[model samples]
Target: MSVAAADPDFATRLNAFDLAALVYEDGIAIDRLMVDFARGLAEAGRRVGGIAQLPPGPATEPGQVDLIDLMTGDIRPLKQRLGPGAASCTLDGSALAAASTGIRRAVAAQVDLVVISKFSKQEIAGGGFRAEFAAAVEAGLPVLTSVKRSQIGGWLAFTGGLGTLLDGRMDILVDWWAETERRRAKTRHRHVS
Candidate 1:
């Protein structure tokens, strides 16, 4: 619940890295990571729930990728945990076609918290915190994001990087929010922190 500032120099650090272009590299894993993140939040407490969007064009990763192993390996098991305070949403069509509408749906559902995980290259390219993501962020959505730190520029990059690239910390976020008394129960309106 603290309004403490995150590492202010994070964006400056991420922009300087010499990472390769992530577009074609491990692209499938990107989507998988996002989906799994949403799932993780859903698993964290008694009232956590999710609204998943399947991106157009076979959102499923390649069969050989062993997604089940990915879900259970290293990362904690999402299905095993359940909290009454989290929810995830998945879009059925192209983001351009459905994301805005989906936002409306969330508005109608009275879900005040939303997290957009940048767990994949595709989503990374989708302008993570721009006119689109920014709309949600501006709306005060609880974005669980993953993005290339370089693009967001300035302090936002580093501070926002967790929402973009480092989603593994979601468990900690869930636990922290719970302890802060922000989430009264799963499915209950969260007190924005």
Candidate 2:
């Protein structure tokens, strides 16, 4: 995967941001990073929600992709077979919509973090997890997702430049989480006062 060059001010930006995207060229490494981040949070007893994807298989066959629901451990297939002669994308839109339920559930449950797999072409075009992303952000949950470098403009427009851009590093992710928790605590304390 094409990881964004590590930004020196990433940690600083994390302190003031709740929405961020790991910008990458390809998806394999980005996927791994997201999974690890969620796993670490779950191990730390933090409530993590949303979906992580298992990349499609070999190039010779039709792609078979599955999305894992972080909160419930459910796997949802994200591709459909459109026949060998079809040159168009085989992504199953219905399956994607169904999988998005996890995001809605996460918002309702008020999870500590929401890890959406990727904000790619579909999301850029106003589909995929766009609404789910909006929901999690609206709920004031810290959100982490990946985006193709080619789609950075779309991501920026969608987030209105309010989201932090992070490299595909576990340490950076950890730093962001710590800062987010600190911010959340401050918000809670202010409300209590």
What C-alpha lDDT, on a 0 to 100 scale, does residue 177 get in candidate 1?
A: 42
Question: In candidate 2, how many Å is residue 80 off?
Answer: 1.8
Score each candidate by Cα lDDT. Answer: 0.35, 0.79
TM-score of 1: 0.39
Which candidate achieves the best TM-score against the true structure?
Answer: 2
- What lDDT tens digits, residue by residue, belong to model 2 across residues 6-117? 3344434343278988878764488778887898889999999999985544652446678888999888778777777888877888778767898889889999988899
Give the root-mean-square deviation of each candidate in angstroms.
13.7, 6.6
RMSD in angstroms between candidate 2 and the native structure over all alpha carbons: 6.6
Could you tell me the lDDT of residue 49 within candidate 1?
19
